[model samples]
Target: MGMNSVNTNAGAMIALQNLNTTNKDLGVTQARINTGLKIANAKDNGAIWAIAQNQRAESTSLNAVVSSLQRGQSVADVAMSAGSAISDILVQMKEKVLAATEAGLTTASKQALSDEYTALRNQIDTIANNATFDGVNLISSTTVNSASIKAIANADASATIDIAHANLSKTNTAIAATLSGLTGTVSAGDVTKLETAIQNVSSQLSKLGTGAKALDTHLTNVMKLQDTLDAGVGNLVDADLAKESAKLQALQTKQQLGVQALSIANQSSGILLGLFR
Candidate 1:
């Protein structure tokens, strides 16, 4: 209470307390600057940290969902492209079959036409078998009910998007079976068979187009969701570097002033030594 006694220096106590407070403030500012996060740990703010952590987890899990969707898209695209090629080949085969059925055609011409048609028909099986992505084929299968491709639609694995297989090969489809029975001398019924094959190929193409579109739409939605989650996490944890920088400068200045104040306080007892002289 009095400058007369060196036993207790009140000014030094106050200055040291202020210096300690400034040091603590400086530490917090430095941490924010170093990490670029205001809530780097639970000690900064537990509730915000927890919320950001959850959002970060969700954003990370969406990476797997994106991979699944992309794989499904590739499979669908391969199937779609192969199916289109098959359709074109079917059209060409139909032209050969029609020419073979002409009334004036010689046996050699008819056999030549049949050979071309057979070659085109055989290509369908090759294309279908090769239409695969990531080891999954959507257009070729020996069984009546081929396994459908499924992709995860959400981060939690609770939902999925399913793409059904379209059997387009000689061993599975009725159109292929009908064409397999053709001879060198094509009949009017052969035209009918090609027509039916065209329609069936068109139908399968439509289905594949629909599935590909659906996958694209869902992928867009999932990507948007991931961006939103990332932004949410940023809002909860990201530091305003500009503000932190300003605060850091202010705290540094305060820290220097605090050290000077403590030095002045510590000299107070020495000043009383002049009284004894």
Candidate 2:
């Protein structure tokens, strides 16, 4: 072969060897640092990276669902506590009326009791009106959170959490003039009127209890769904540390072998150099 041909052949061979060593070392270094066989897009490993990326997107979406569910839980808790307090006041009101049934309560005392009953009702209304979370009130209105997240490249996903407060209306007991024992000619048959008012209050109390129980049910479901989402996210994107560590060890060994192979290739080039001399 001519000098130019030999020189060209040697250069091409050396370049190919260098390229091989460089690619091998690059693979090892990437595996060591990333601890992943595929660090970049799906093009690197079409099947594996594609699955990983899809799983990662699903995990991200589930995380958002969990967060929204958590917020829904908070709203439900506050509503539950406030409802309990209102129920307590209603029980106290019943006790007061029972006390008046035997003891001759003065008109002024009856008026005072009525005023307190009204105040308690107003307080419940206030709680329902003002119970807000992050500038949104759940007790007063049914809020549906259209919480959305763009986790996938070309797909849109959103979730809605319905926040509904239990019915907080008071079980009102209408005042019977006879119950007050005021000097007004309320007919004897009006005794049944007082009983009816108390009955109305009791019936309403039962309805409110049912409503509160339903709200509690919603809260339970929210908690369960949140836990499920958390578990799903963990399964999707969370790294398996033990597996990654094993891969790291293998990559380190590959790196050392790549370096030694490169040295052998350089020695082969030196043999060609001896022929020229």
Candidate 3:
């Protein structure tokens, strides 16, 4: 317990220990600054890290849901566009049929009206058959059996939104048959059939519009949820750069002071040589 023993300098030992602790703390602050994360890994805070990781997974899964919803929206949009075109053509066909019904019409004039009506009718089938998006057709006869576009609605894939199909091409066949052999005339029945077809197309368009709207609304919600989850994860793991920067400056100063203190403790042993002199 001598105050000035060269072999057992307690003061020096205590100073070295304090300096080592300061170095350790400085290293931790530097790491936080470098990574911009207070909890960069499980070693930082195992429980909080685990929770953030789980939330990150959910956010990633929501990306898939957004993609599915977007694809469904595109399919619905294409179908609705084609349905609207068909509706317009149906109106034109009705006009032709009505004109053909007029009295004292010349044979040539009747044939001309019938030809225009048939062409418009054919266009409806063409548009419906071609209305496809990402290989999904909501208004095509080929997809009538499957008859719906389905999209994932949630991160867990537990929920879904389905947009039903409308087979305009197949329905057009009835109109075609009704007006067959219309070289010089159109019957009252043909006009009635065309009117019904036009109404059906309108209803189908309304349904498609609703389904597209659902997709848009759901996509927006999912995006918002992803943003919120991302913010939550950030709260759990992200570092406060401003705080860490301040801590780093303070620790650096403390480390320098610790080195100076240790040096002073070592020099204290040199004072014993002065007594011998």
Clashes of each: 0, 0, 0
Q: What is the C-alpha lDDT of each candidate?
A: 0.86, 0.50, 0.84
TM-score of each: 0.95, 0.55, 0.93
Off by over 4 Å in 1: 1-3, 142-146, 181-185
Better of 2 and 3 by TM-score: 3
What is the alpha-carbon RMSD of candidate 2 to the true structure? Answer: 7.5
lDDT of 3 by residue, 102-211 (tens): 88888888888878877887787788888888777888787443268889999888999988877777464545445643565567887898788777778878988998
Any idea how many clashes model 2 has? 0
Candidate number of the best TM-score: 1
List the candidate numbers ranked by TM-score, top first.
Answer: 1, 3, 2
Residue lDDT tens for model 1, 136-243 = 888887453345679999999999998888888776565654555235456898888888888898998898899899999999999999999999999999999999
Error of 1 at 26 (Å): 0.9
Q: What are the per-residue Cα lDDT tens digits for candidate 2 across 140-188?
A: 4334421211111111334343433344433233432223432333343
lDDT of 3 at 180: 48
- Candidate with maximal lDDT: 1
Kindly report which residue pairs in candidate 3 clash with one another: none
Query: Which stretches in model 3 have alpha-carbon errors above 4 Å?
Result: 143-147, 172-178
